[model samples]
Target: MNFLPITKQEMLERGIEQPDFVYVIGDAYVDHPSFGPAIISRLLESRGYSVCMLPQPDWKRKESVQEFGEPRLGFLVSAGNMDSMVNHYTVGKKRRRTDAYSPGGISGLRPDRAAVVYSNLIRQTYKKTPIILGGIEASLRRMAHYDYWSDQVRASVLMDSGGDLISYGMGEHSVLAIAEALAAGIPVNEITYIPGTVYRTKEMDSVYQGVCLPDYQEICRSKEAYARSVALQYENTDPVTGKTLIESYGTKGCIVQNPPAAPLTIQEMDDIYDLPYMRTYHPSYEKMGKIPAIEEIKFSLTSNRGCFGGCSFCALTFHQGRQVQVRSHASILREAENCRRDPEFKGYIHDVGGPTADFRHPSCEKQLSKGVCTNRQCLFPKPCGNLKADHEDYLQLLRKLRELPGIKKVFIRSGIRFDYVTADKDPRFLEEVAMYHVSGQLRVAPEHVSKPVLDAMGKPGHEVYLSFLKQFQTANRKAGKKQYAVPYFMSSHPGCTMKDAVKLAEYVRDLGFMPEQVQDFYPTPATISTCMYYTGLDPRTMKKIYVPRDPREKEMQRALIQYRDPKNYELVKKALELAGRRDLIGYGPKCLIKPGKGEQVSPGMQKKSRKKTIRNVHKKKGR
Candidate 1:
């Protein structure tokens, strides 16, 4: 475990002993404090168990297990940053250029390496330690999934990793139950009755079924079904192994829907905000002056949860449920105060926003009845009329925070739903957000310029992004502020093709704004887009379309976004030629290639030609 504050030697030297019952091993971005594993670990600690948190353990190393010295390391918990399965898809089989895990070569020590290393280490040292794998990685991929890297479906991580149990979605209740049972000397296999857990049968040849929840099968059949359920349903089988899923039926798998945002009690918000955090830099006294990157910090407080925009590529509504869960304004203020007081405080707060920072509450008051309200435009394909739209309270909350004494600046870094911001009947909120909250660049995911791709991704439309861009620019100009909208575009999404990518590249070029940051669609387990990417269309809608499933093509399409870069010119050319979209050449000022020119050779060829030309020119000069 590579911990920041306390060195392994320091823990050993101080004679700090391992806890008696639990050992948690997982990935954590310090900023995401309310994320699954961290929240679950805190819940367990609150229950009075001896818990050891090994944050972001280096599971690739065999020696990483030494962090837990050996006090009967009862149970191992596995939940990495996002879904481990999704992380596997990005790197496990297909090579990714921007993949953080494997940048240069296909490193064999990934995907299952974390699970294998931890399980093998514990088995060798602890002999009979119980290991449980959960989180999106394990849950959605708990059964065999289409292994893009392997080009074949493989068994779920639970079966492949050889763990004792795999708990799926929001494991707070399930983990606590498991911990209580373990403390009482309950056998691991007997705890199969627990909901949101997946485990192999006693024979280790098959899976066993647990209590089934409602509408589970419907959600897994297709993206539309999952969307209809708002991703609160779970349905999937191992794509390769075809093994029968044996976990509790209808148990929303391990997708933990967040508590609703509306009607938030002040006390609950206080409890969440007041939680202790190491806010300051732990490395050195001198390094304390500099703030850590947004990626490096421990503990992030979610001001709200749940989204209504319902983009197809997103899983928030399904995971957190459409109902918004907001912490009280005062509670957020207290949390900020606590973070500032921490010895780790570097005088900076990462971000204070969620799903859509502007739309802070359920779109309608009908949320009190759990009835669908359809006031706002249905962001999803089948827009629900029951959806409400409100940003007033959220705006007030933002204003209150700016007045906080210790806070230097509060950032709305979480990607905002721009359509909602523009839809806000009140311009004051947008004005304040532009003037006070924005850190110069606001990230808005317009996703695509093509209407079909936008529709598939559940975005409003390309025009909406353009409209928002105009409004944002106008707002900035009115305020004498030069803030820009950093539109987040996705390549190779389910309904997107090479042509779509080129069109988007042209659109961005036309806007005279080239985004350095672009997101390649990563099909994680249970995301609607992931399902569509693999199966080609919504299984329920039966709408057929072209999907760029080939990893090479996906890469080329992604590179086309940076067409102006000389290095990426060939990639853009290849992408355009491959898509038969050469007509778009020189469409905008950013387009590097000239019209009617022969397709330039590869960079290698160009380099060789340049050398030959230079040598011949030198020879002529010598003569």
Candidate 2:
């Protein structure tokens, strides 16, 4: 159960001549399932293949990637769990001071667009060796799509990095298939039939059962085409009903993305989590300080994969899909026992959840066989009548984990789906959560209080959130606990006008909570929200929506969310005035802003301005 080798010295010490794969990663090597590189590397090792990890190699130096020399099969690359662009920059598109995934929580360990950068670096040294790209960065950019940073539609990452192929999505099944093929002496260039992979091909003629997307040039020339293309890609994400998609890049050829690999069975899910993970960062990184990303998940257990919550702003639908595949309770309990034995165990299990904590199975039984609805959402607008809203399994799992010998507490901090919680016919789960699980407070994403904005965000309407809030409070009261519901709110989302921002400010003001943090909508790749932010039309409905593109207006929207702050007073006042609600700019109890100490303009100057307006009207009449 020790870590796979990361250096040539370690490889030789293990009696390995040439490694089977040289794994290049954007993040520091952490042999934990939470890290994508660890999963791929460990899985390869379990199959009797040698893998050497090259973490955060300096793209500037050719010797960095040369450390592993070359591998027998190929080199597998990933940009860690998070997209490098999202890692490097904030929602404001400003450079962040630290990278939590890096050793010492440092910045600049990996360059922006790390997958492409690392892939290109590897190609500089090994021209003919297979280069396989995976993880969030490569997965999201695996086709002709928009780049928020560059503010343009870029070609597939396979094209951008010149990588031989890309293994998208969770990549557990697809990667294994790829590894087997490469080990069997298949050339990387000819191995294009694997599902969940995107590859460049000159002959689209060989592709079957495919939908041809608009050429890159056509999409680039018209936002309409781009939206349509993105919509098509979105529809064909489910493994049960999806088709192979092909998009051209002029004379160079085309990029083909095969249908996603089928969801892992319960046994398979259990097997993946059962891998012998060291469950911590490499020991060699000890001197550099701890990897901050491990702090939350150090004692957490992932109970499931994929989400049916169907958040428009989320990339899970595109990556993990909508089917909920979970591990058996026996597997989770085993992980909990292992947690108890760790030297650092403090009698606390941080979380036991996945993309959404409360979801233990698919929203409905039919989803696994027939696929989720591509056009409509499972929980948004309204929870469907067919919704299998049950929490018996998750509740039982929590109870078992809590009753473990060394466990003092089990917190559900991975984030619970509040909407799902409210949909349950029984309130026992809510009451139990309030009594035991929460760590004094629970965080939920009711992104906003405005219905129109929530609709555009593909979130359940405001009433559902309000209903959930009441239940949360009532449960807390009955449990005699002083628990708080900390709602996460976002500002400047598409369809959020200044009027809506004011309404949100008023709602928070009534609740007597002025949030300290507000997210200005980030236009990350492949999400419906990102598409709307770029094209100014909702991709789901192709309807024009108001976007707060003006930098100052966006600032005002943010300020309005925290209107109580003195620094935001001016911005909030201006926003209120611009929304034609100047009545809200005074010291009334309902007012969002306070009045100034002095008049904005002299009475004489105002009279003169009024007279000049009259004169202009008379002059126009004379003309």
Candidate 3:
């Protein structure tokens, strides 16, 4: 139940000399299952391997990584829970002011491209140590892909980080195999047979029956080739049908990705979460103020892993895969009881779902054995005919939690696929959510109202969202509650046009509400949308798609979402003119904004504008 050793003295106190693994991470060490480093380290500890955490080591000083000295087995490196670049910079490529993962919500604790930087730092001291890369940064960048910040395609992280092996995806199975092999004195070069791992080698002679991707130079030379390679990598993500993939780097070597590890069994998922976790940030961080990241998740329970929703913007398909894996109700309840007993318990459970809440089982029965379809999706384009949209198991789980004596509220904040809800025949799940789970507001992502934009984002059409809203409102009425649906929308996604932006703004104007925050489409690595952003070609269809890359256009599109705000007036006005929608500029009932001083407008329209403005101001004062 103790934290892993972090220093030579702590290692000695634990009666260990040189430990089995030095887990060098890019975050302040938080011993919680929610953090990947904690899960991996605790899993290793449970398997009788000594692990010393090196959280946020000074990358500028090689001696910082020497605190725990060289490990008996190897050094495990990760760029914390998030990709370091994503954490440090906004989607606008502007530097962010705070890092939730760092101590006191401070930025600059971890270096950019942290996995590579930390791995290189370790090499400066322990040149021959078996460095294994894990976590989201290394996992997503395991192969050659586009780097948004660098504005070019980059080589595989395994090549740049100089890591001997990459345990991609949920790494428990591959990591254990790696530890056993290393303990048996197998060299890292010889440990290439493990599933869910990527490695480099000069000898391609041993790579049997593997798919050879376009050479790295070819992809770098051709964006279309890169798109093709992305599609190939995506198809090989399932454990049952996925094949070993090889990416050549000319003479340096070939990077080989073994097929993904099999999804964990229910019992195995239970065992992993049941491992001893202090479930909080390291006590040393107390003086620096609580880690902001923990506040959201401290009371939350992760009931599932993997997603079947198949979101194009999400990197889950590349990391966790599309196969849904869940923990048994008994296991989830055990964790809930632990939370109930905690001193910080407030009779509330923040969340009780994973990638997509309410996905308690695989998308279909066959997925358990045959894996998801390589070329098709379970919930997008339209739900597959075989898609099982049943919510009975999830409903029962929620009901059981509500019946718990000490639990006052059980909420689902991780978001659910509303289209999936609509697909289910039974109406009880939606009814229960509106009645009990929702805390007056249910946040749903309907990304955009434009049909083309929706198709590009792989999200359901606007009509589906509208139907869900009607159903949700009906359920709220039945429960005698005035609940609201807070729809989340994104702007500047690939395939989004100026006209499409206007269409979304009109939809908002009709609703008489403006979203406080808007998400500009961020082109992180390895996502289908990111590929489209960089290549201007849909990786799925290899068709050319319109991408709004100009900074001014991006801002204008964002402004349209909050057109009601005074600050966005000029941008919105300019956007309306550019889209040939100046008709929406005057004081018609459908108009988004009124004309400024000295602007030409009909006398009738001017009178209406004055009346509307007066009503709006009165409404504000009443509030």
Candidate 4:
């Protein structure tokens, strides 16, 4: 069977041979290896199960199910990166823009496009197949998350999808456990004791309980909290048994499990790079001259896992851990060689990075021998004095890749921690990195401009990001290169009010950059900010303050950063007016929103009207 695309025809062809286990449904990007579904499949296969990876089957179509043959056991796993709740908005409303590109059709709604397509097909082809649902898309949405898409709190994926169980968090261990028990003839309803698994009660009245109550009051009580706290809170609860193994107050109970600690040795990391990848679209799509999105075109190579940079909005440190684990240099070089053989080789290596590209090896050499280091760099906002601060080894690896025969240019497309770059003892190393590794634009995530917000987000001060930008500019001028730093900014993050967003907009305007793109904070399940958003207090330090939970207010605050757009004038105006800051309007480059003179219409309002007209025109044409 075709492992990548499980088309209907292939399912019919496989009908003659019944597999020992079948992964019923869900989504997966063809490129992600470390993703949940892929990892679960690998683990089950290791246990001697003849598993079939049915990625993103068309669950909406009945014909799609008739293709896949019946199996001994059915498994349903989602694309691990996303939460299924996102689907309810995307699918239920038939919101085209959100649903078309979604991993799961319309966040967490029944007949989820992907699940419905696959489940319908299975029911038509095979009767009474036991289906299981797992992954971030299924896991976080396993409980009600404030669904911005639908603007309402919805039930967990188990309730919505009608799946046997909803497994949350890093699922390697839980998936293996479930497959083993099923293979041993255990009933699905009796397997609620497992960690990271969520199932309904026998009567379907409430979720079951296996573990003790988590300290929700403590964890969710704080106004400003870390992402780790939120993730830990959910992972700690076993929804099937309704027990909380990990304790914290104000936090919701969830089935929590740590990512396997058996760090992929450097050699293992290197070997993974050597695996073959499909670098181009299939022939059928290519013949029609259709190019895939950049995410689809780029060949992704993860040099390491986890991160020490505890950026609040980011879940990397929580999900992957702060300790850096690397693959061998030989393994990376092997992968580069393989890419050269592909027909689509363009001489440009997309990205060679992990959570933090400059951080190589663990923070300390003793971590491997000592079985985990308690270095405070991974925990607190303050930099550790004794922390290992060197990039010489990582720099050498980049140089070696440049020397390879097939590779023409290597770019560090993954984000670089500017503070780490400034901390490096070797000035020459920084010079070499700027000169050799950069493509046209180097992307650096400064996140926000306000000091309080940056601190709350667990990032270095604004000056550090500015210092690196200056140094990068100087280096580019000296080398006669035209490369520029692409500063990524986020608006409406925790602690960011209209004032903070305006400050960020001023900073952007002073830098003479009118950013066309900006990120509005997305509070996923198990994120610290999400709890703060819901509870109005930081979980770490029970401080209470106002959080902009209203979606419209958040969108308006985000719009302030793009003041140059006449289209945003009204949004900026409303945001500033609501915040009672009228002085910023009608003056300076930062002023995108023209202030209303007591009663006249604003430029932003006009733009909105125009947009509405265009949208109505399209509606009339049925385009």
Clashes of each: 43, 0, 0, 61
lDDT of each: 0.58, 0.88, 0.93, 0.59
Compose the digit string of candidate 3's lDDT tens values, residues 221-289: 999999999999999999999999999998998999999999999999999999999999988899998
Residue 413's C-alpha lDDT in candidate 4?
A: 69
Total backbone collisions, model 1: 43
Q: How close is candidate 3 to the true structure, as a TM-score?
A: 0.97
Q: Candidate 4: where is the Cα deviation over 4 Å?
A: 1-16, 24-49, 58-66, 79-81, 84-132, 139-147, 150-211, 214-262, 267-297, 365-380, 578-580, 586-623
lDDT of 2 by residue, 1-623 (tens): 67888888988888888998999999999988878888888887888888999999998997899886888888899998899999999877889999999999999999889989998988888989999999999999898778888889988899889799899999989999999999888889888888899999898898887799988999999898888898999999899989999999889899999999999998998888889999999999899998999998888999998998878789998998888889999999999998899999999999999999888998987787899888777888888888999999999999999899989999888788888888898999999999989879888889998888999888888888889989999999999999888888999999999999989988988978788678888888899888898888887888888888888999999999999899987898889889988777654466676567774634544555577778889999995
lDDT of 2: 0.88
Query: Which 10-residue window in model 3 sums to the lowest lDDT?
Result: 601-610
Error of 1 at 284 (Å): 11
Q: Which pairs, if any, clash in model 3?
A: none
Predicted candidate 1 versus true structure: per-residue lDDT over 293-396, tens digit per residue: 22333434468765666666666643444556577887877777777776766655666777766656667665546433332334554334555546778777
TM-score of 2: 0.95
Q: Can you rank all candidates by lDDT, best first?
A: 3, 2, 4, 1
lDDT of 1: 0.58
Task: Please estimate how well model 4 matches the true structure, expressed as its whole-model Cα lDDT.
Answer: 0.59
